[model samples]
Target chain A: MVTEGREQERISVLGIPSLGDRFAVFETMVKEHNISLVTPPVTKHTLSLGARYSPEFACLPFKGILGTFIECLEQGADTLFMVTSFNACRMGYYAKVQEQILRDLGYRFKFLRFHSSEKGLIGVLRAIKRFSNNASWPTVVSLFRLAVAKLRALDELEREVQKIRPVELEKGTADRLYREAIGAIDRATSFASLRQAMRGYFERLEQIPKDAEYAPLKVGIVGELYVVMEPFFNMNLEIELGKMGVEARRTRSTFFSEYTKWGTFLNALNDEKKELQKFAHPYLKRDVGGHGLESVGEKVRRAGDYDGIIHLAPFTCMPEVIAQNIMPFTKEGIPVLTIACDEQLGRAGMLTRVEAFVDLLERRRIGNILR
Target chain B: MRVGIPRALLYYQYYPMWRTFFEGLGAEVFVSSPTTKLMLASGCSRLIAETCLPVKVFCGHVLSLANGCDCVFIPSIHSVEQKVYSCPKFIGLPDMMRATVPECPPILDPDVDVNTGKRDFYQAIYKLGRPFTRSPLKVRKAAETAWQVHQTFQRRMLSGLTPPEAIEGMFPQSVEEPEGNGSHPIFTIGLIGHPYLLYDEYVSHRLVPQLREMGVKVLSPEMVERARLRASICELVERPYWACEDEVIGAGAYYLGRGEVDGVVSVVAFGCGPDSLMIEVLQRYAKRLGKPFMQLTLDEHTAETGLMTRLEAFLDMVRRGKRPQGISPPASWSQRGGSKRGSASWVYLA
Candidate 1:
């Protein structure tokens, strides 16, 4: 508070590579600390840059994040935030390797890392303190709450978009509204304004002219989180399916929802997750690391709801590879189409496969109707 | 009861303990035949194209055990160390086998995660023994003996014996020393990789035997003690999170830093997840130290002749020693510097 003349340091959290809008939350959080936030969207340049510097056979998400880091550094981001997991996947050591690569590239920056499993809320507070320019705890905590509220609202908007996209009368209508909703949500400066923005968008989304006679084919998407959530990595698969007049429902929740579910005692009381584990128990009895358990569980659990299941994964993703191998034997009698996404995946090839799968699903439905 | 074990993956590291335990429990143990071309082909046919070679080999071994025994033993090893996991493929091996490998016998999968306290660890052992005999006392005795044998195997490895030699010494009649024991080797090469890749002659293309024939002494990660490995791996900026990294990063760091071996060779399966990162870390470390390092990537298509050519070239470079210090010309070049060499240099420049 005493030094008003200190230069402003720009802060940037590790970008999700696809969901650039989520960085707005971090921007708001850093605002109280007098640090500017650098939020950059993933581009082709980012993918190529990350792939060049990353170790071959490292998963797709790692390359994307590494590319984003280089981009952030170039954009005058002096402080970078990243979270590492404790165990299970290769994700835990991502920060370590990325830090090494960044240092070797001769980038001058400060890295603030947190173990996703360790220290819990206190760890987050301490990490914020490192780059927060000595902002008071109460202000930081309030701003953090506001950011979490915005994140939850943003996730809700994403889910709402998915529901309306398939049945909309005009294509791209829902996507355009989503972009507009995001801008309005980002402009909110308080929790009440955030709530107002969310509610208004929810009403506007429901009012969009949707096809009343269209009964869309439902497909459950399950795989590694980064590929499932990141549109660029999966080639905007959800939107593509929606454009084809098929509804894409993601079996896995976003990161914040996952935290709320497992990070708290609600994990024990969540019957939906319990049912998933129960159904998956026969096939995958233990966690195979990453989303392998969830992938299997969601397939079995949603066999009745989803007309088909698309197992999207990165090539050589250890857990998902195991899941894909075991999926056929789940014996849920549901048709499964596994698409392993890698840097080499082509949009034309992916669309052809997806089109064939949808055709099969439609034929199966007709066969059932005749019977 | 006849229990079969696939001679793959952790089998090279823990076969002694498993064999001793099965015998003590009054069950005849049948280990699958060593890795062969036919076995690997059958395994690859069942799995997707992207699985690492080691897992594919493991599947092949499991398929071989289908008709021989009443039940097959496949352990779901979550983690050997606290908070450090085995590769996902290993943790989910039993599930994969059940789904893909047709006509496989009933599997007895005992979970082993040392992080789950002593009681849970013993419970897993008891689960393994219950199918053999009803008495808990027999199971306890078998577990105790198995632990001792595993410890002995580890100690022998640390005392300058390779895994194959140490395993052979466990059989009382074959306490013979390794061949060419007294002869001093011209070059000692540090071979770093997983036990399965290092000891599986088919996968490794008989690397150890070939090295021995070439008057080279081979040292593997198993020959290093656990405490020494722990100390050596601290050189890394971040301690590796994989349970089996001691075989790759730890051994590579030790050999490169201490100059204990003249050259370091890391053998990695082509699509292996853990080895991908571990190899990068070691390769960069070796480069920083200006050490002679070679990476031999193994896959289904790895040809023996190609591997041999690379091995010979790397060894030849090691024998030549470090590059001549400065840009000094050779004696012949200096003598002809006035005419022939100057013309050749001009042509090269052009």
Candidate 2:
């Protein structure tokens, strides 16, 4: 340990994986530390880069993140961060495998990963200490609080966008506003500015001229996290559904809420997971890894609120495959459509399937009134 | 009462114990027939197209046993060792069966997780025995007997017998062991994969038998000593917490590093969650060691001729003693690996 002082005495240029629009929050948090964040927008080339080197059967998220890492490294990043889990999910091994792959590709980068749930507060603090470059505990704590607040505000804005999108009087107004709101949120660095942006966006989203008499069909989206969150991966399913005048709600909590639920020491026992397993008891008796239990449980829990359920997953995703297989047995008395996406998935085919599913739900709703 | 067990998945690994436990409870154990094209086809018809091949085969076996027994035992094995988890599909196997195979008899599904704690593990075992006996003593005795049989089976496997060869006590005598072509020498090749994939003659397309006929000696993961396997696993920068880590990563690393085997061949079912990652790990190790590595992915659509052709080519390479030269791994990391002394030293703390 004492002999490698030369190797250990380098500046750390940190790279964080891209997932949705959460890059804004990651940037704000890491900016205060000595580590500089590499924010790479996931492009078509990124997906191709990831898929080329990644194992043929790994999930899309792995491919996407690996591509992002490669991009970051190309942009002069020396350290990369990833979140791992200790469950039966393949996410746990992502860092290890990706590290090996990157190493074999001749990159000399530092890889850091932790099971966010198992690590708890102390683990997070230790991890922060490593990347923060000796920042005081109080400063780190405040920065962490800001990151949490920013994440919550972003999720709130997203939820509002989903609601106003379907019933907006003008076509495409809601989506246009959403793109602008995301940019505003990303630029707001201070707490006061972030709060102002959140309030202003919420007001703008709410005032999107709505048709008073329109009753949009409501659907719940559930499945693998990456596929559900990344619009490009799912081919903008929410925006497409909104264009078709259907309201889509995400049943899976955002990653921020997920962190609060599982990353804290208090929630280490996984009461939420146990509760989901309970709701899924009659169909799925245990946690099937990933969001599978929640997929089944949310359907059972909120079957009455939505006209239908849409299950989206990356191809060959284990837990989501289990969820898709078990969704039928739940027999929640609602139409359920399972769409498995991969690089080979065609946007046209996906849209046709969604259209047919929405049509079926519409007919069912009208038929119920006739009865 | 008759209890049905599928001759697929964990059945190859735990048939002895399961048979003993059911028979000790005074019930006749009925095992479904080995995998066949027809059974796999029927199973495939009922499942999502993306399910791994083994689970689909298990589903087929369950369908075949629909009318043959009073109840079918499908244990959801979550974790066998502490801090290690089985495949997600395995944990949800019972639920998959419940949803897909409606015609099947009542399922006696037990949740098995020794990682959770010994008490809960025993409770699950006892619950599986409850319908047959009310006395707790009978359940404990049956459980003890099952454990003894399982350990003996593991010992037999460790003694270098494949599961089928050990269980039946009959090795397939090669009609003629082909001489390694002309100037090439016979080689010892390490075969690593899940027991279900490796031992199933139909799924594997008689890989072990074919390798034996080629005059090549085969070393499977089961044949490796437990201590050596554990030690080899520690060599990994981070130990895989997968329940079957020993079968793939540990065995592959041992063979690659120890130079006991000429080359390592891994058989992974297409779309397997853990194998997809572990195979990559093995490939990297093989690259680092300059050992020839071939990954054969089996699926429902796998052709027998293609498998045989690949096997013959791989064996030929091993016979000639050609090192597979591919992409070089990170030089800095490998140099660092040499200096890192212990298992705990490689956690990559920055």
Candidate 3:
């Protein structure tokens, strides 16, 4: 509550674990802006604490974020910044609801919600400025650019890792290398070092002796952003697929690309998403909110290329619920398995489902080849 | 051609306008019967398990209409007001209906988005009318007449009539408000919820009339003026994104703050995202004002006796003038031996 010595106090920004590459970029930006950033590691304890405090029917992402926020706050985070939307999805209300719940529980912290509906980069910059204690515009701009570059490099490395995961001769090699790669990217302070780190990581990934004869089953991961991206929420779905010798391709990986590519002011412009809108037209027709349209489009577009599609979304997610219902009707020949993740979902159950789906895909492929 | 409109969701609110619009174009409009056990069973069987009850009920109506109608009209209403959107389920209702009920007739979905501009809103209406008539001028005329009828319907509600009553008055021959007992109501209680839940006799188990029978007058959000409701929500940190939620919150805030009503009862559908948040909002506000507040969350399995017992108990507490002053932990109102057919749960937040 004391504003006089606020600068002397540590400023910690809560990070979403789902944003794999963007997390590193965010850390870099915060450091450059001269603000201390604190990212509490998300664990089972975090999930429990979040689930306990959150409304019973709230989505997994909301509960996960609440849990992470509480953890960060416990570690002396004086400020919490969150991105909120005014869309049709329940996502729009999560911030306000979480803030109220936290406040009710007597947590003392400055809560700042950035409305994504705010036009262009002005909203984002304003949020950045407030978070950075009004850091110079030039400094903010430079750091943002650096973060974007790092994010791009990180995404490329992740894609390479995903590609090599299933066919690697040495099991777990891709996972181990990817972890190290993320660490390197996070530690890289300069743009050149970031590029070099990514290049080095990709080279290491390529060296993982892969079976040339093995045609790995390719499964496209589609659904809500958090579940698709956050390994914990989805119970390490991609990793599980890798262990089963299946390549998992995600639809939206480059988190910051949409905002960063269109200069600082035009952050909301998403041309790639426009193409998805077109692709999903036959089934979805329009945006049903959240990433519902994207989920449908990605599956439809990649139906021929992928062996199967796994849709992971939180329970009670309206848009994904709509998508899941319509998916059966699409009849794209690709087996689509929808996994609704929530606090009630257990690891064993999720693993069993994922394993069964992989087995089905493998059988279908084998059957096709034989025929 | 006969056009079917499911008496679910927005049908309770906009049936007058839609019926008028379709009838003006010379199409015989048929509305599905009120929710019944058969419809609920059929809906639950067809719909995805996670969707809210109203959506399932809508699916049932679609199924009913599929039997005899040429096409079912389901509007994808993105935003009814500027800067405020509807729930995602409402926006994607048409698609969900089509996907769920494979036996459903052809769906005539017209996009109604006021967020873009007024022109787009009218253009969407005209596009929906194009299939009914050739002349754009005739469509415009029909739209204008329908708008007037819609305005009149809203006026009737603002004049202190419930949504069902207003709709009944609008279509005297088609629907009728059940005649009230000659006894005058002794107490007033604000009943807040979406029109679909509040007015649907089968979903609510005739809660409005039951309250009236017990000498309590029900005041719904529909009775309040739109401007006043909007003004009342100034206390909120942000305007609720969902249009119906905004109104409910605004009206609930007004009723709770005014101190005239004995208590506020919110009827929420299970799995409704907006209602879940709004209930919290109303609970917190009601707690601050030291008012008796109870949330009746309904699903397909809600029992009539359990609901009646909770209502009777809530009313008794109100009449005794023993409103709980402090905030209480959320507690379920389920009774022993209650029918557990649906996932209906009640939470009492004083």
Candidate 4:
């Protein structure tokens, strides 16, 4: 098929796990590029598309991606824009492998990387213009605005995390408000109203009692930082635990970077000083993987405080993987639950697992005042 | 004076070093053996049910070493950089293991002396060496020599050289790739997994050959350069917070998007942390690109039949250009997709 004057080119894009309001960015990019956005149908078929190609041990995200591509094929998508990085972990080379596999299967698509983005605004503008071909300049501007709005809103929400974490209000209540606010923002029109809505939401969020007496169990959520912060990405997990009457105390939050960084090393010296100031305890040594702070947290919890501990993380996080290798011998012998959440957890299943975790905590421990 | 070492966590990497280090000081080092099914099961039963697999494995090793060693060595490991963390269980392990296995033996968890900012590791070693010989200087000398030996060994491992070679004074032969018959659909498949799992024949159930049967070539991270991997990542998004896991994810995306390799397989130990995030990210990327990807979460109890069945299905689907037998994925996919070609004449070198 010979294309005419402006070369009416078709381009396709894929969506990975929601990194918060990135869709607005894509929608804008599509219009600016004069590209028709073809979202692969997300169904059991798409998952099988991945299962057919992916190794069985891979988590749900791989399957979800494979599924999307098959859907795109059925929808007549031509090019697949793959964006990612190589550092941090293993997902960097994912696009290349998937592309090869898709090619082998006779699905033809042009693969483009965002590598050219680093060349500055000119390079970015040139690439966008290359894709946008027939699109008007105003169209590109509008798209950028949408992307900007989405990013701004997400950045604002994450900054207010202190309102939801431990030493603040009840864990679940703030999340409840946050989710409600986000959902409302989706339908909101005026930017002023969205701010007011978020404010109103946070205000109500403060109303949720952080100090709930006689809660059945208090648990600590510790693990890799990325999965900890993203609620939808991790399955609305904290809120689910709360509904079961479990007072969740997530220790790892965005706010504690300074403390976690400096304090982690200082903890060893501090523990020694605490020991020296008290009785000459012979065996009061630091524990496995150099986490004396957690040992102290365990002691505090064991002292009629939190009933259980929960370690949450992504599967590949090596450090946490090492840390998880050890924690069985706390003073309290506290029952600990380790939960790993990935993109595969679609609300219902995650809530069920969380519910079960809470139930397990309840059956094992007695009600505590601090919880 | 037996210094007990729990055969868990860094025991995979540090076992030989710590054992040799302690022994060099003339203190008998008693390292625990691998935790077996019985020990792991017992630990699982004892600990909370919600614990990650590694934590369960650690509990097993701790229980296994409880009565066997004089003092179980629990190190207080901290991140060397910002935003990095050792597994959460590690933080509370010394205390937790101490409480759980109280009678196993006395644990050695020496915190740093604030005044000197030194851990009891050297001091404790010096004290333990007293029984071997009462010379304080001699003990210090032995400790220093032992530390030097350990540092050399560690440096070798970091250099991608086998740790065992540092001691034996001989490096292993080059990693040989099996000669392949030239054929269509050449795939340089990237395999993401823990070194233990990738190297362990028993655990992975000989996954490489299984893929090779379908003409898929495997590339482990150990085989690639950091530069090559970094070059493939999409620089459009913000650089990820995690350097290591992000590299694998980004590299996999890079190669997969290159239209060179057929597919990428992420084999993970069940409950391993980095894979948790990486697998999700890979799948998300694949979804966007409308590509095929899979992750295998393996545990000690990974069944060969289960693995084989899944492998066969995935291979079949990749070759057949459709979902394989007994496999029906999500009926549709995300409308948001990855790279695609506008024209049929587009030269995609796959």
Candidate 5:
């Protein structure tokens, strides 16, 4: 408060494109906390940069985050925010190693990490206060509430998009509207306007003409959070499935569910995760980290609902590797296709695998109908 | 009932306790034979390509025990100490075995978490013992006796004996120690890694015997007291969460800093998360101490001849009083520098 001519530091958080306009809400929150916010869009070049400097065997999310951090640093962001988990997964080591690598590479930026488990809320608050130059708690808390509401709204919009994408008569209509909805949500400053913006997007999505006669094939997607949520990392799998006339349904989204879990103390009462554990008990007795157990649970729970399942994980991900190995023996009739993605994976190869899987599913469905 | 124990992973370290506990419950203990080529092949066939070698070998051992045992004992040990975990594979080993290995016997997995107080510990053991005996009191007595045996076994290992020697010493009638002990060796090398990687002769290509034949003494992490090893790693920037890896780091740092051993070799399974980070930390510390450090990452494709050659070269360097300095050369250095004359650089297969 005493300083007159001091410049405030710019803060940046890595954003997944599939989260749509949810990141814009985060940006608004940061700005409200009296800090400059920089949102660097994840691109192919970002992935390459992250992979280039990261350890060869590091998981995909680590490489993606590293790439984003490097890009943010280049864009004049003086502070970077990251989240770490305390689970058995490799995520706990990612922040520490990435910071070491970043420092070794001679980057001059403040690195702030928030623990995803026990100290989730406190860690975030402390980080925000420090990064935003001692912003008042009341301001931060209010902005945080707004951010959470926006995330929930964004998740609802995305869920609707997933439902309508497969049955829509005109392809890409749902995706385009989602992008526009994100922009409107981002620009809406007040609670009333935010609600209006969300309603507008939902109405627009409903307007997209549906194929009444077509019964789209439903495929459940489950895996590590980064690969499952981010389109580019998984080769735009959801959109591609929609283009193939298959509906891609995922249980977890990056923002609403995960954000709420981490941003509040409600994680301890997570009944859904408890139910997943019970379902996965027969296959995976323990949480091997990442979404390994959850992936198995999702498949087992929705085996009858979805025609097939697509299990995606980064190369060398231990937990998912365990899940992938166990998935073959689930006794559920649904066929599962496991794809391990890394930077080296080519788009053509991914498409071929996906296309082949869809063809197999289609053939199986036709054969079942004939029988 | 015959309880099958796979002689892999934590078996080298905790076999005595497991054996004693099962026997106390009136069950016959049948340990899988030493890792063999066939077992490794069987493991590789059952597991995914991305899994580490030790896990694959473990699956092989499970396959070997399929026909003979009534139930396979695969403990899902979550934490041995407060905030210290075993590898994730250990936690999920039982489930993985049940999924991959067909015709496998019923698995006996009692969740072990030392962090959750002694009551829970006894409860886990009591559950394990329920199938054998109806009385919970008998299970408690057996668990106590097993604990005592394990403690004695640990003490025996700390007194400069290998895991195999300690196991033999614990159960005198069960195993025989080879004759002709050499009074002293020309050079001593600190061999550090998880017990399974270090003690599994097939995985390590009989590393201890190979060193012995070469007039070298091999010192493993087991030789050091657990408390001493714990103290050694206190200065580390981040204490490793994996209990076994933490011990390896502790013992490795202690030896490297004390300059007691001429060289250090870390035998790790390929794609192990804990080992990779721990080795990196050890490498940095070793470099600071100007000691020769080599990390041998074993996988399914590991060839005996190539491993022997590297071991010989490393031992030869130690014999010549040549201390390695700075960063170690990459694995490709051997191929590239082989054509050049008078270049003695060897590859560190990490």
Candidate 6:
């Protein structure tokens, strides 16, 4: 525990981009608790610092978290609060691994995880209380209320994008609206206020025009759903593809993909277990981790409705790798363009692939279908 | 109308078994012209989003026979192990095929475990065969005899003869050796995937050595031939309906378990409906056993460089150990083998 008389000093909370979402919560929470918040830069160095020090098979999130922890520790953030979940994916225990990895780096920051105490309202306050030691109840309550509001707003606004973005008259307009809605969510103090702010953001967002013409090429986004739906995960490929003038069609929505892909996570039903097939690619073969996004992608292709396919998955994800191999068989005649990204991805490079893929699709469209 | 068996996958495992039942029922059988491009394309096109590419391709081949035959003999996978069977996708395949393909009568095996055994598979065939003739008893007898011959022949093949020659004495059989062509370094590729993915080379486009063009030889469990692979079986119970997937993976496990393969690589369908349950165990074996390995996922959009680059990198890691600090490891590897530090052999793909 920190010394009781450690000046009640102002400790700044620092984070990398993945934690950028938590910045507003941190700003308000730290203030109420007489602390400060600092967000670090999203840089190649941030990634290298992580890539240089993580397990080879660890997902990109691990790398990003490592960078955040390092940046914060170096910047004198004495205490770090990690928010994680009981996800069906292995990432749920990421905090434990990250904590171990960070400690090995010899940083003396106090790691306060949300789960070590209560998982809900009462638990969060207790962890904060124990961590801060000097914080009062009222301050905790206010911080809790603000954090809850921000988290809800973030989830609500992101979900709302799926509803509006796909149906919007403009191609990229809903995405822009999503950004604005997120900002409104970040600043929101209450549920009612967040809803009001979100409505206004959406209204204003709808005013922008998204000119998505069929453009002779319909590019279907395939592979693991995590990278396809999550912008932060795949470096905003959908928007980039939209800008490249290609209608990027993805298979699963975030809600269903994340929730259902890991349906048998606990194996509670005592499902049929078989001998593990040793594939050339363990990372690519298992469909259990992610929603059968690879299967979903293949099914979409076999339906034979698209021009080309774009597969996006995290670096070491197995199901996506397996799907990537069998895809050639699924779409025997169609041109397929696959891309995988991690936190280390450069925006320009990813865009280059999307651009090239679109170019190929367009050439095929005009050269064969149109003629 | 006759059903065509591809003589692949289940046929190898259950042909004598399935044939006795089909022939006893007086069903004329025709298998595909081996997994050629046309049948593969036909099978590939017939698959929907819910199935794996190999299964999808199997459907394509099944559909190829559907037009000329009375029914496509793709069974409803109700149970693989008495009751707690194979993957749910396999169980629902006949339904999926029935829904996806309209003009075909999907010959199904509802449940093939104990009480509802191989006879159940034939029951469906008998039901279909009833449209042509009467007498399920005659069908049963024929199925049993045909199965006896098929099993006897299967035993011969497992005794280390070619698949064709082993059955030659049983019927007017024609056996031919697969093209082993040249004496290339038997580049050990760990065909680590579900049975369907490994054996159904039509779907796993990476099965052969296109990657080997860059100097790699392919090694897979299926390529090892079941006869020579008996030593790979870690555990056994005399069970006819052995999870074909288990056996296939057992074949790969045997390959890696043998410890002779230079570098092991795994290729799986992007969303393997079945391997989901199986991979956890395989990973424990691979990761814990410290096997030199790489895994590549196949789906509609897997990139050439990414696959080749990963393959090359795994081979490189096995070959060079690691780069000597200055030379950059291949950009494809997200985490470089940590500055030539790893004890295992995983080098730069480049």
Where does model 6 exceed 4 Å of error?
A1-152, A155-224, A232-252, A255-371, B36-67, B76-350
Cα lDDT tens digits for candidate 1, A170-256: 988889988887777777889898899889888888899999999999998999888887777778888899999999988535445
Q: What are the DockQ scores of the candidates, in order?
A: 0.65, 0.64, 0.57, 0.12, 0.50, 0.03
lDDT of 1 at A267: 35
Q: How much TM-score does chain B earn in each model?
A: 0.89, 0.87, 0.90, 0.63, 0.90, 0.68
Residue-wise lDDT of candidate 4 within B72-159, one digit each (tens)? 7876443323433344344445655655555667666543222233454457556656655778888777767666766666565445
- Which of candidates 5 and 6 reaches a greater TM-score? 5
Summarize candidate 1's per-residue lDDT along B129-225 as a digit string, tens digits. Answer: 9988999999999989999999999999999888877888887554654666436787888999998998888998988888887878888899888
Better of 3 and 6 by DockQ: 3
Worst 10 residues of 6 chain A by lDDT: A268-277
Model 4 TM-score (2 dp): 0.47
lDDT for each residue of candidate 6 in B1-350, tens digit (9 for 90 to 100): 47656544455455556655666666777766556567655655665343455665666666666667656566544454542344434444454455455676545434343326666666665675565468777765765676677657656644533333334444455454443423665355555555455444444553453644555555545445555444443332112222444444465566656656655566666555334323433444454445565666776555556666666566666654333546644555535333223444233121
Where model 1 places Cα greater than 4 Å from the true spot, the runs are A1-20, A128-131, A261-273, B172-184, B322-350
- Model 3 residue A139 CA deviation in Å: 1.6
- Tens digits of per-residue lDDT, candidate 6, A127-219, equal 556544457778666655656566655655555554445445556677766666655665665667767886787567656554444343556
Minimal lDDT window, size 10, model 3 chain B: B336-345
Q: Give candidate 2 regions above 4 Å deviation.
A: A1-12, A187-190, A261-272, B170-185, B322-350
Worst 10 residues of 4 chain A by lDDT: A252-261
**Reference contacts recovered by each candidate, as fractions?**
0.67, 0.77, 0.56, 0.15, 0.48, 0.00
Per-residue lDDT of candidate 5, residues B214-280 (tens digit):
7777888998887778778776545666767555788898787765687888887888866665676
Worst 10 residues of 4 chain B by lDDT: B341-350
